[model samples]
Target: MRELLRSAVAAGACALLAGALAPATAFADPTVTIEGYSTDVRAEAVSALVAERGLGTASAEALLRTQEAATSALDAALAQLGDSAAGGYLDESGAPVVNVVNESAATSVEGVTTRLVTRTTAELESARDELEALPQVSHTAIAVDPVTNQVVVTVGEAVIGAAGTAGLLAAAERMGDTVRIEHVAGGFEPAIYGGEAITGGGSRCSAGFNVNSGGQDYIVDAGHCTAAVSQWNVGPSVDASFPGDDYGLIRNDTGSAPGAVSLYDGSVQEIASASDAHVGQSICKSGSTTGLTCGTVEATNVTVNYPQGAVHELVQTSASAGSGDSGGALFAGSVGLGITSGMGEDSSFFQPLTEALGAYGVRLN
Candidate 1:
C-alpha cells in the first residue's frame, strides 16, 4: 500500500495523517485561534464522488491504499524513467496506472497498473513552452496528466473569445492530440481577502499553517497576500517569496501560530508535519468562504497563470473553494497538505507545504 510514515485520523475524517503522523498554540490574542475542518466535509465530498463519478466506498478505500504505496516510490519512479515511463496515478476504477514508453517498463509493481504512451514527457514540455509563448494565453493552467498521458491545458472562458486564443488553439492542434484544452467558466485569481478581519492586511487570506523557523513562530500564507500587507492577525510580516514563488511568512510577535487548521465548525486538526501531495491522493481544503472541501488530487506540478503573474509547482485537485480562501490550509488528516492558492468551481489548486517550508526554512508547529 502507499506509505509515508504511519496512519491515524487526520481531523475527524476517515483520512489518515499524510504520514499517521499537533500541539496547542499559546494564544495571548483572543482573535488568534485554531479551527478544525469538519468530519462532515469529507462525507460530502465522498458522497459527491459516489453520485457524480460512480465512485463507491470500496473504490475510495482502494485509492487510498494505492496512494500510500506509491507515494514514496513516486520520486524514484520519475528518476528511473526509461524514456518510457511518463508518470503514474490511481484511476477511478481503483487501479494504479502508470504510463510507459515501451513494453519493458509496463510490469506491474506492488500497487501500480501501466499504460503505454507515444509521446515522451520532454516532448510535452516542449509543447508547453510553445503554448506559454502565446500572448493570449492568460488565465490558463497546464500540467501533464499521466492518466491521460497528455498535456492538459485549462483555460478560462473569458479568454476563449480572445484573438490571441487562436494561436493557443493552433498550438494544441499541432500537438496532434497530445495537448488537451479544457475551459473553465471563471478565470483563476489569487483568493486573497482583506486581511483586516483576520488580523491581517485589508486584503483577507486564510492562515495556512503555524510554523516555527529558527525558534521564531510564524504563520504561512500566499505571498501575494503577504506582499499586500505586512501585519497578520497575530503578528508582522517577516519573510516571503512572491512573483517568483507564492508563500509569505508572518512573524508572531504577540502569540504563537497554532499547529492546526480550522474546521470552521469550531474544531481544529493537529498538523503532524508537512508533506508534498500526489496525484490521486484525497485532499481537503479549509478556506474562509467555502470552509472545508475535499477531493482527489487530479494533477501535480501544475503551473497556473493568474492575473497577478505565473505561479508554478502547484497541486491541482477536484476540490472546490473560492474567494478569501487564499493561503488557506490544505491537508490530509494530520499531514500538513498545502496552502490555498487559486480555485475554480470544478477545480482548486495549492502550493505544496513542503516547498513552502523549504523555501522559508520552517517546520510545522
Candidate 2:
C-alpha cells in the first residue's frame, strides 16, 4: 500500500505534489452547457481534451457528444448482435464501429459502421485466458484486439531479456498468430503513495465514485489501496477485492460523499451515471499526481500481471497518470467509467466501474 498521511514528511510531499499538478484553471467555474446535450459538461474536462488532443473547446465538446451518442448505438448493436457481435469501438472520428462474425448480422446493426471479422469475441477471450493461465510473467499485459481479431500481449522492457520472457515468447509462438506479442519500455505496477485526495493508514489514493447500498453511502476506490489501508480520512474500508480484480468500498461515515469527481480545479464534475468503457472512446481521469488528463480508450477486458499479482478485466487507456493516482476517477463527460489501477510505459489500466458496482451491490449516489 502507498501510504502518505501517516508521517508529516510524507503529507508535506503529497501537498507539494498536489500543488504542482493542480491546473491553472482551478479557480474557474466547473460546468458548462454544450449544445444538443441535456446535462452540463465539466469545463475542466473540456480543457483536458484541448490540452491532449489539440482541439478547440467547441470541437472537444462536440467530440464528447459524438462519443456519448456512439456509446448508445453500441449498446443497442451489441444487444441485437449477441453472439454475432465480435466487439465494438469508436473510430477516430467518434463513430461507432461494430465487428461481427456473421456478415448478415452486421446488416442488422444500423446507425453504426460494421466490419466482418474471422473470430468471435469468445474465441479471442479464450486465447487471452490461455495466456493468463501461463506462468505469471511480471511486467506483462494481455487483451483481446477485435480490430485485429487476435489476442494482443504486451511485455515490458524490464523482462525483455529474462528467462521468463524467453519462455513466454516460446509459448506465444506455439499459439501462432492468435497471440500478438509487443514489447514496451517499462513494467506495470500499482500506482500508490504521495497522494492528496484521500488518505488512510499512511497511504493515499483518489476516490473513484460515491455509491449507495442499502441506504448506506460509500466511496469506491482501487482495491489495492483499500486492502492496505483499513481506515481512510473519508471513511473506513468495508470491502475490497484485489489480485483477481481491483476494486474496493469504503463506508462514507462523513455523510458528505457526493456523486462527483474532482477536476483538480476548484470545481468538480457531477457524475450522473456509470457506463462500460469502449475501446477508442475519448476519456479523462483526475488524480492527485497529474490533475486532469484526457485520452482515448485502447482496449478493454485486459489482464495485467503486476508484481503483486495478476488483475483481470481491466480497461486500458492512452490517458496519462502517475504515482499517487491510484483509485482516481476515469470518466467521459458525466458518465463514470473506471477506477485507476496502474500503468505501463505508454498506457494506463483501470478497474471497470460496472464490475465493481456489481461486486458491491451498489449504485451511483
Model 1 Cα lDDT, one tens digit per residue, 26-136: 112233222332344344445445654676755543444345446656645655665667877766654556678887777634346667788877887788777777773
Q: Estimate each model's TM-score.
A: 0.82, 0.87
Q: What C-alpha lDDT do the candidate models reach, one value each?
A: 0.67, 0.77
For this target, which candidate reaches the highest TM-score against the unseen true structure?
2
What does candidate 2's lDDT look like per residue over 299-322, in tens digits? 999989998989999999988888
Error of 2 at 181 (Å): 1.5
- Indicate which candidate wins on lDDT: 2
Alpha-carbon runs more than 4 Å astray in model 1:
1-45, 58-62, 73-76, 93-95, 108-110, 160-163, 194-200
